[model samples]
Target: MDEIVRSNCTDRMRSYLESGCSLHYQNISNLRHLHSCERELEDYINEANAVLKKLQRLVEDAYDATLTANLSAVKVPDYSTADSKMNHEYHFTEEKQEQPADELDRDSSLVTVMILVHNMLKLDYTMQEKIVRSLSLKSSSAEIESYRLMWDLRPYVDGSVMDLAWKSCP
Candidate 1:
């Protein structure tokens, strides 16, 4: 009876050790899973930051184009002539005509629109290149799709629309 009791206790101890080992293995697996999740989250954040930076650059480019358009539209009208009398008369009238407030506003608006269009053109090119480069870099499908949309809008952004706008306005 004493021997039998000793044998039973030994068997119980072996089973307990096996159960503890299995629990330890499970804990290790859980930790590995957590680590993998953290890595994936970090990757997502980095991708988001890259996209945001690209978008900010595009906005800045658009703003610059608008400023250029406005400046170009405000050029003084040239009235030079070979006739001395006509030149004097032209100068006299030119000096008297103060730019109307509405004219100034119109000029500003036109400039803004032209600039916006130019910016769009630049964005189209930039986006196209970015998309191609990203594809080469093995970027995900979502990023490629975003760039494709920008690429498709390029034609309208060309100066032709702005030219038409000016023709229609005047």
Candidate 2:
């Protein structure tokens, strides 16, 4: 992974830590705990959205750059004055386009996957937020336990994508 990508990933990790989005309160037995959980959820959702917006912009810029470069590389062979296209002789020389093009494609794909993973994380955060909001004093122990398990376990987060991101860590 490159420096920019590695540090962007670290930025995300820092965001998560700052927001405390990855925490779970298994036992919210009182009003104070409940309100704190609610506040934490709100903070988490806001922070997650901010991170997602930044990621989206980065992804969009990468994709747009790739598109612009690809468009410039594509050229139409002009044969307006030629009698027959097949009979016309053409000289083709591939001028060192492979390496840069391959790198652009890789970067584009990386940003795409990064956004996808971040969006997955955003959705997971939303789900946890909903669970937190639904909590009440009358809620059953089983339901609270289930919610805690879901929030802590994070079933919605794609492990493979996260693993790839972690591999980029410096």
Candidate 3:
């Protein structure tokens, strides 16, 4: 659940108890209360979106920094070597002995993985937004409850993947 939802949430259990069992949401104000809640929810989501965007920019900057640093250490292949023609055709360069290729490869791979994780988070948020927008008077109690659980649990976000992403972060 979002921090806003957790902190500023209304007394939902109390409200549910106050409403009589014979009533249907569609027959009443058509979830006007819930509509207001949705707006607040959207505001929280927007805040999160902004933060995610910022995080992505930071990751991109880090990747660019590492790339530039590594690029500076590369040396053009010696044209006089017999095998130079075969390797130079691909424009591959040799890394300075001081900077091991494995370390650079690890940095590049980390950047790629973080990017993939960031995209997954973006997609997850998009799905959550769609789910929030889908709520209506016609929604059954089961459906509404399902939506609540889905929003709270954020099933689209893989916990292990997120943990891995975090673990790899500098």
Off by over 4 Å in 3: 1-32, 77-100
Tens-place lDDT per residue, model 3, 98-164, is 3567778778877877777887778778877787778776889999888778778876677887787
Task: Determine which window of 10 residues in candidate 1 has minimal summed lDDT.
Answer: 128-137
Q: Candidate 1 at 107: error in angstroms?
A: 14
Question: Over the stretch 1-170, how does candidate 1's per-residue lDDT look in tens digits?
Answer: 65765677676566666686356667789879866765664565567557756755765675576556556555655545435456557776555545544555665566566556545655655555455445533555787676667666655366666675567465
**TM-score, each model?**
0.37, 0.63, 0.60
Runs of candidate 1 exceeding 4 Å displacement: 1-22, 78-170
Q: Comparing candidate 1 with candidate 2, which one achieves the higher lDDT?
A: 2
Better of 1 and 2 by TM-score: 2
Choose the strongest candidate by lDDT.
Answer: 3
Q: Which ten residues in a row have the lowest lDDT in candidate 2?
A: 86-95
List the candidate numbers ranked by TM-score, top first: 2, 3, 1
lDDT of 2 by residue, 48-144 (tens): 7787788778777867877787787676556674445535443323446677778777766676677777778778877876886788878999999
Off by over 4 Å in 2: 1-29, 77-95, 168-170
